[model samples]
Each structure stands twice: as C-alpha cells, then as structure tokens.
Target: MRIKNSTVVITGADSGIGRATALRFAKKGARVVLASRDAAALETLAADCRRRGAKALAVQTDVADPEAVEELCESAVGNFGRIDIWVNNAGTGVFGPFLDTPLEDIQRVVDVDLMGVVHGAREALEQMRAQGEGVLINVASMAGIIPQPYTSAYSMSKAAVRALGVSLRSELRLARVKDIHVVTVSPGAVDTPFFDHVANYTGQDTRPIPPTYSPDKIAAAIVNVARSPQRELTVGLIPKAMVAKHKLFPQAVERRMATLTHRKHLKATQPAPPTKGNLDRAAGDDATGRRGRKTGGHGGRTKTMARRLLVIGGAAGVTAFAAFRWRQ
Candidate 1:
C-alpha cells in the first residue's frame, strides 16, 4: 500500500515510538491522526505534522475504554474520510514480583497492553472490512517471546499481544479480507519513555540500559512493516537471537532465566513516591515533548541484570549451536 495520502491512526502518539511514527508517516504525505489521553501533546504533534505539510488531527483517546476507542476511530474516519491504517501503540508496564505486584497494577497493564490492542483491532477491522482494505500494527516487545523474571505482568501482556496478532492475521485472511494486513513489531530495549513510566514496586528512578536504539529506528521499521506487511518482525539482533534460542532450547532458556533471577541483587529500599504522568495519564501530562525519565527501582534492577545475563547466555548458546551445525 502506498503511504502517500493514506489515512493512518496511531494510538499513544503523544511521545516515544508512536510520536516518532506519526511524524514519519505524516512526512510521507499520509493523513495522520494522533490519539492519546494527552490532548495537549496530541495537539502539539498535530501542529508539527501540519507544519510538515501533511493533513493531521489530534484525537484524545484512552484505548482501554472501548467507547473511547470507538470514538477515536469515528473521529479519524470523520476527519480523513477513511481509515487506511490503525497502529495500536498505546501501552504501559508494571515491574515487580508477580506475587507482590498489586492486582490493580496487573489489571491496568493487561487492560492497556492486551485489551487495548483488542479494541483497536476490532474497530479497525470493522471499518477496514467496509472499505475492503487497511493495516493494523501492534507494537509488542521482546518480552513477548521471552518471559522476564521481575516483570511477569508485562511479559504476560506482551505474550498475549503476540498471540492476538497471529490469531487476527489468520482470522482476517479467513474472512477473505486480503487487503487488510495485521503485523506485529517486536522492539528490544529502545530509548523510550516506557521505562520512566513503568510502575515500579521498589522505589527508585528509571535508568537506561547500556545499549538502546532511538525511537526513530523503531519508527522506520514500523513504516517498512506498514508498506510491506509481515506477520511478525523482531527488531535488534540480540532480541532476534534470543527468540531463536528460546524456540530451539526452551528448557535451556528457562534454566538460564532461572539462574539469572537467583543471582540478582535486590535490596529492600523505600519505594519512591508513586509518580503521576504515566502513559495512562492524559496527553497534557507529557507536555515536555520528550521521553519521560526512566526510573531505577528494585524491580528494574533485577530485570536489567537478568537481561544482561540473557545476552551473555544467548550469545554462548548461539555460538555452540553454530559450531554443532558446522560439524554436522
């Protein structure tokens, strides 16, 4: 599908990957709608898009609310006359031991990550079915393929998203809607506000991983996926290797994760005052027009350590596997 003049609606477009993607598409001459709870941020993004000479609209939306999602789609269609692409990018994460994590926090993560995607797909499919063409892009994470120790809720939500994307792709095909495409974009540790906004059980500020890609890299990949829909695309070489290793040696992968978790250093630190302006907040909350500062907490530290171990183990596993294959 040609990007120029296409109507695309992006949820969570106030900042981060969604914001980057919105700008990318708008620059390509696509009619773009920026949707999020932050009306002010959405307006800012829309203005920027307009300045770039692309038609744009800002729709204040809470994807967890089915009614809000419905209105979002309606507003997009009302403004653009049709929906060509729907990118379900709005999401939130909570990090803590599954047993210790608040049920409310878990439910909130599930609501935004999993159910939100469901709502976006439902609305986009209905409208696309009518037009006989469209695209749906679900932003999943590397955690979708590999379960993380301290971030069980987040892992579960992403895993569900992966399943949802696969199931929806098949269902759309069965319905004979060949023109409509469903693609999942799995990104590794990207430099986004996701970490800063993640709910942390242990009180600490968010920190960055040693190596992280900018949102622009992810936006570029999403644009490519929209142009040529693939069932799933994994970004980053390390993440791709981890996914492959898990598939070939599930037991070994599980054992590696267990070992890393057991060795993680966790201190009983005072929880930081719960911060406002998470992804769940309205767009105006992110008025800085920048990715939120990442927080480093007990949960975040454990997960970070685990990821480092996984990289080392995954690399070793790959090397061994390659040698074995060569010998064979």
Candidate 2:
C-alpha cells in the first residue's frame, strides 16, 4: 500500500517504538494521528511529524478504556476522513516474582497490554471494514513466545495478543475479507522506555535482557509490514532464533530464560524501591531517554551471555535450521 497521503493512527506515540514509527510514517508522507495517556508528549511528537512535512494530530487516549479508544478512532476519521493504518503500540509491564507482585499491578498490565490491543483492533477493524482496506498492527513481544520469569502477567498478556492475531486472521479468512489485515510484531528486548516505566517489585532495578535491538529496528519492520502485510513479524535475529528454539525445546528454553531473568535482567548492583511505575499514569518524558541510554549498554559480557544461552538452550542439531526456516 502507498504510504504517501495515507492516514495512520499510532497509540503509545509518546516514546519507544511507537514514537519512532510515527516519525517513520510521517517521513513516508503519511498523515499521522498520535495517541497516548501523555498528551504533552503526543503533541510534541505530532509537531515533530508536522515539521517533517506531514499532517499530524494528537489525541490523549488511554487504550485500556474502550470508550477512549473508540473516541480515538472517531477523532482519526473526523480529522482524516479515513483510517489507513492503526498501530496498537501502547504497552506496560510488571516485573517481579508472581507472588510478590501486586494483583492490581498484574491486572493493570493485562488491561493495558492485552485488552488495549483488543480494544484497538476492534475499533480499527470497524473503520477498516467500512473503508474496505487497512492494516492493524499489534506490538507484542518475544515474551509472548518464550516465557520470561518474573513477568508472569506480562508474558501471559503478550501470548494472548499473539493468539488474538491468529484468531482475527482466521475469522477474516473465513469471511473472505482480504483487504483488511491484522499483523503482530514481536520484538526482542527493545531499547525503549519499556524498562524504565515498568512496575518493578524486585529490590533491584529492572533492565532489558541482553541483545536488545533499537526501537528503530522494530519501526523499520513495522513499516515493511505495512507495505506488505504479514501475519506476524519478529524483530531481532536472536529473538527469532529463540522463538524457534522454544518451539523445539520449550522446557529447556523456559528454564534458561528463567535463569537469565533472575540474574542478568535485573540489576543487582542497582537497588530500587518499588513503585507503580506508570501503570495508572504516564512516566516523565525523560523516561524514554536517548538511544545510548535505552539499552544502558549491554556490553560484551551480556552479548557473550546471550550467545552462550543460545548455544546451551537450543537443540544443537536443529537450532540453525529452525532459525533459518523461521526467517524464510
């Protein structure tokens, strides 16, 4: 589909992959509608897009609220006349032992991560069906495919999101609706405010796991998927490999991932007090950070750790083939 002059709506436009994606679509000449709980950030991003020579609108929205999401859709149509692409990029996480994490925090994660996507998809599909063509992108995570310890709710929500995509596609196919598409984007640990804003119950500060990719990488994949709709896209090579390995050795991969989550994923040296990190509210603008701060520089040691995990956790014989085939 031609991006130029297309109307695209992106949720979570305040930061991370969503922010990058909004800019990308704008540069491609698409009119962008930005949504987030952070109205100030959304407006700032919208202005940036406008400066890039594309029309932009900012809508303050809480995706967990169905009414608000519906209004977001209405706002898009009211302004642009039609919706060409809708991206459900807003997400939050809760990190800590399952028992230690607050039940309310877990519920909030599911509400924002899983139900948020469902709300967006439902609203976007409504507009798409009427318009006769559109792309609905849901930003899930590798955690959906491979469970990450200390993130039971996050993992469960993401897995549900993946299943939502599959079920939507099946329904679309059975109904012979070919133009409207549902695409799921699963990225590895991305360099985003995700870690910064995640509710952490652990005594240690939380960080992205090793081998994290830039949000731009995921943004690029999102644009590519928009151009040529696919059922799903996983962003990084390591994540793709991990997903494939998980399919073959679920128990082994889960155990290894759990170990990694306990050790490397949390910063033992950096003690942090527990806070309800942006679950009920928005984080400060600085939470997004510059590119350099995003991954906090995983360094050689973490990279080596990632590689070793792959080597030990994957089935030696089929690992390479599975990873290769997954990409194809």
Candidate 3:
C-alpha cells in the first residue's frame, strides 16, 4: 500500500520505535493515529505528526486493555473512516531471572508485549474486515528468536509476539483475506528508551546488549514493510546473524548470550532496587525519552567473548563437524 494518504494507527506512539514509526508514516502523507497509556506524550507526538503534514489523532490507551484497543480502533475509524495500516508497537519488559522475578511482573510483560500485540491484531483485523483490506505490522524482537540469558519474561513475551503474527497470517490466508497483511518486525537491541523503561530486578542499572541499532532503522523497516508487506522482517545485520546463528548453532549462540548478558547487561551498571516500570500503570517522566543512553562501544570485547564462548562451549566443533558432513 502507498504511504501517501493511507491511514495508519500506531500503538505506543509516545516513544521508542513507535514514536519513530509515527513520524515516518506521517511524513509519507499518511494520517496517523497515536495510542499509548501516556496521554501527554501522545499529544506531543500528535502535534509532531501534524507538523509533518499529516492529520493526527492521539488516543490515550493501554493496549493490554482489550477495551482500550477496541476504543482506539473505533476512534480511528470514527475519525478517519478506515484504517489502512495498524502497527502494533506497544511493548514492555521485565528483565531478571525468571524464578526471581515476581509473577505479577511476568504477567505484565505478557500483557503488554504478547497479548498487547494479539489485541491490536484482533482489533485491526476487525476494522480491515470492514474495509476488506489493511496491514498489521507487529514490532517483535530478535530476542524472541533467540534466548536472552537473564530477561526470560521479556524474551518469552517477544517469542509469543512472533508466533501470534505468524498464526494470524495463516488464518487470514485460509480465510482468503489476501489483501489484509500481517507483518512481524524483529530488531536486535535498539538504541531507544525501551531499555530505560523495562522492569528491572537484576539489582543493577539496565543496559542494552551490544550491537544496537537506532530506532530509525526499525522505523524504516516498518514503513518499508507497509509499502510491501512481508511475513517477517528482521532489522540490523547483527539481528539477522543472531537469528541465523540460533537456527544453525543454538547451543553456541545460547552460550554467547549467557556470557554477555552477564557481563554486558547485568553487571555492567550500578545496583538498583527492583521496579515494575510502566507495566502496571503509566510510565513516569523518566520514560519520556525516545533514545537509549548506551552507545555500546565495547563491540571488540563482546566479539572476543563470543569466540571464547563458542570454543569453550564446544559449539565451534559442532559447527565444523556439521559443515564437514554437509561437504561429504
């Protein structure tokens, strides 16, 4: 679908990838509908979108609430007539050992990250049915495809998000809704306030793992996907490599992730008390920023650690043996 004159609804438009995507679509001449729990932030983004030469609406919403998502769709169609594209970018995270993390926090993660996507997809599909066509872009994570060592709740939620999109697409295909597209975007650690907002229980200041990309990278993918929908879109070279590595050398990649998530994520920052973040309610002013603080200047050390982990974890030999067998 052409971005110009298309109506696009983006959840979590207050910050991070959602914010970037909202601006991107707006600049492309699409009418933008912004949804998030932060009313003030959404309003600000709405103003920005208007400045970008697109009609904009800011709908304060918690995507975890099916009612709120329903209202969002109603508002969009009520205002714009129909939604041409819906980007399910609303997400939250809880970063800690699965066993140590509170059940509530885990539930919150699922509510926002996985079920949030489900709610948006369902609502979008309903609206698309009315129009007979639409696009659903879900922002998943590379961690969804591979295990992150410490953030089990977040990792699991993302994995479920991917599954949700894939399953929905298959159902849509069977139903012959060929023009209604469901697209999943998987990006590695991105330089966005997403890290600053996750519920933290590791007793340390959170840091995004290495090989981070800017939010614009993911936003561009979203816009591009809207132009021509694909089943799965992975952003960043490292993210693509990580997914491939996980597919062909799961043990090796798991070991590497374990080692780095310890040194690079958990132990790299100062200690802090556990918090539920924005999962339970609206995020604080601290979550207002769009970009992450970490520049991740330690790529060399991470690469070295990855090599050492592969050798020590015995996966290097496994890869070589598999290659040899394939050649034979």
Candidate number achieving the greatest lDDT relative to the actual structure: 2
| Prediction RMSDs, each to the true structure | 4.7, 3.8, 4.3
* lDDT of candidate 2 over 1-328, digit per residue (tens): 7799999999988888899999999999999999999888888888989999999999999999999999999999999999999999999998889999999999999999999999999999999999899999999999999888889999999999999999999999999999999999999887777777778999898877777777777898999899999999987667776776777779998999999988878888999899888899987765334243536675212446567566456545466766777899
Q: Name the lDDT of candidate 2.
A: 0.87
Looking at model 2, report the run of 10 residues with the lowest lDDT sum.
Answer: 285-294
Q: Please write out the lDDT profile of model 3 over residues 107-196, one tens digit for every residue.
A: 888888888888999889988988899899988888888868768888888888889888998899899888999999998877777766
Worst 10 residues of 1 by lDDT: 294-303
Selected candidate, larger TM-score, 1 vs 3:
3
> TM-scores of all models?
0.85, 0.91, 0.90
Local error of candidate 2 at residue 190 (angstroms): 0.7
> Could you tell which candidate, 2 or 3, scores higher by lDDT?
2
Q: In candidate 1, how many Å is residue 241 off?
A: 1.7
